[model samples]
Target: MDNSQKRILMAKTGLDGHWRGPTIVARALRDAGFEVIMIGMASTDDIVSAAVDEDVDLVGLNVGGHIDVAIRAIEQVQVARPGLPIFAGGTIPPHAAKQLEALGVEVYPPGSQLVDIVDAAERLTGTR
Candidate 1:
């Protein structure tokens, strides 16, 4: 598929209001030629609804709360759209990252490179 044809849905699963991380990631994805739809400060229901309704090829989640919060969104999104690849970044701890990885969601904690995140988006969206 063409790189520009891929669409990504980005949402912040918590009410943190810290937009720097997701904003940077979204910009990077857009720079790489992927269409990015950002839904800031969303709940599990909102995330699932947008993921399905937007027909996005990939979901990028910004988790700024307890692992359970992100997990809830992940589980619901998986049920709503199985096989829809997800990648996440934010202030996630190591244990939480492991949990997300176990659920097949790629996790990028603080200090992660933008290039790597963009590459993951491309791969997850099948635009690589």
Candidate 2:
């Protein structure tokens, strides 16, 4: 892991106009020395392609709108790059969070600390 460059693919799985959460997380990931590939308002195809094409170590999604959208993207990413670690954040509802968690995505709802998210990126990508 010391010789590897940890890259993270960050995507928003909806048309939601909010950029604060993902932007902040992206910047924080960058500050932590991760190469963050951001595909804003991305579809499932876009997310999956980037997850593979970008050669990313981890994938982070902003589940802002329909929970199904995030689930679809996560599923595609899993198939495209099986066992790649994924995480998600947003004002997600309890049931939606449960669904994501069931998919093995570390769900971070509103008020989740930046340190925690960045730490997750490190752990997930084995950059710690």
Candidate 3:
């Protein structure tokens, strides 16, 4: 698939309001030719609505709060769009990472490389 045809919805799943990580990843995705839509500090409803309304190929969540909050968003997204290719990144600890992984959400915790994220997006979105 052409990079230009790929779209990703990049979202922050907490009120933490930290942008350094998500912004960097979003930039990398954009630079790689994916149209990235960013919705900062979004709740489950916010994330789901954007994913549906935007009709993006993938959902990237930047989680920086209680895992339950992020989990809510993840579950809602999955319910809204099964197999929608949801991935996450942030200060997620090993336990939280395991939780997300069990939910089928690819977790990219701190220190994750931007290239890896874009590559994951490609693979998850079936554009690789």
Candidate 4:
């Protein structure tokens, strides 16, 4: 698939207003030619709704709160849109990353390189 044809839905699962991490990732994905739809500070319901409504090929989540918050959103998204590839980054500890990985989400904790993130997006969307 062409990069422009791949849509990625990005959302923050908590109330945290820190935008630097997600903003950078979104820009990188967009620069890499993917259409990125960023829904900032969304609830679990909002995330699931956007993933379906936007018809995104992949979901990228920025989890800044407790791991359970992100986990809840991930579970809901999976139930609502099974097989929709989901990846996450932001303030995640080792244990949280492991939990997300177990749920099939590609985890990129803080300090993850932009190139790696873009690469993951390409692979997840099959645009590589």
Backbone-clash count (model 3): 0
Each candidate: what lDDT?
0.92, 0.89, 0.90, 0.94
Model 2 poorest 10 in a row by lDDT: 1-10
Off by over 4 Å in 4: none
Model 4 scores what on Cα lDDT?
Answer: 0.94
Pairs with steric clashes in candidate 4: none
Tens-digit lDDT string for candidate 4 (1-128): 78999999999998999999999999999999999999999999999999999999999999999999999999999999999999999999999899999999999998899999999999999988
Model 2 has a clash total of 0
Output the TM-score of candidate 2: 0.95
What are the per-residue Cα lDDT tens digits for candidate 3 across 9-120? 9888878876899888988998999999988888789999999999988999988989999899989988898889899999999999999999999999988888888889
Kindly indicate the candidate among 2 and 4 with the higher lDDT. Answer: 4
lDDT of 1 by residue, 28-117 (tens): 989999999998999899999999999999999999998999999999999999999999999999999999999999999999999999
In model 3, residue pairs whose N, Cα or C atoms come closer than 3 Å (at least 3 residues apart or on different chains), thus clashing, are none
Candidate 2 local lDDT, 1-128, one digit each (tens): 54138888888888988899999999888887788888898889999889888998999999889898889899988999999999999879999999999999999999999999988888888777
Error of 1 at 93 (Å): 0.5
Which parts of model 3 have CA positions greater than 4 angstroms off? none
Clashing residue pairs, candidate 1? none
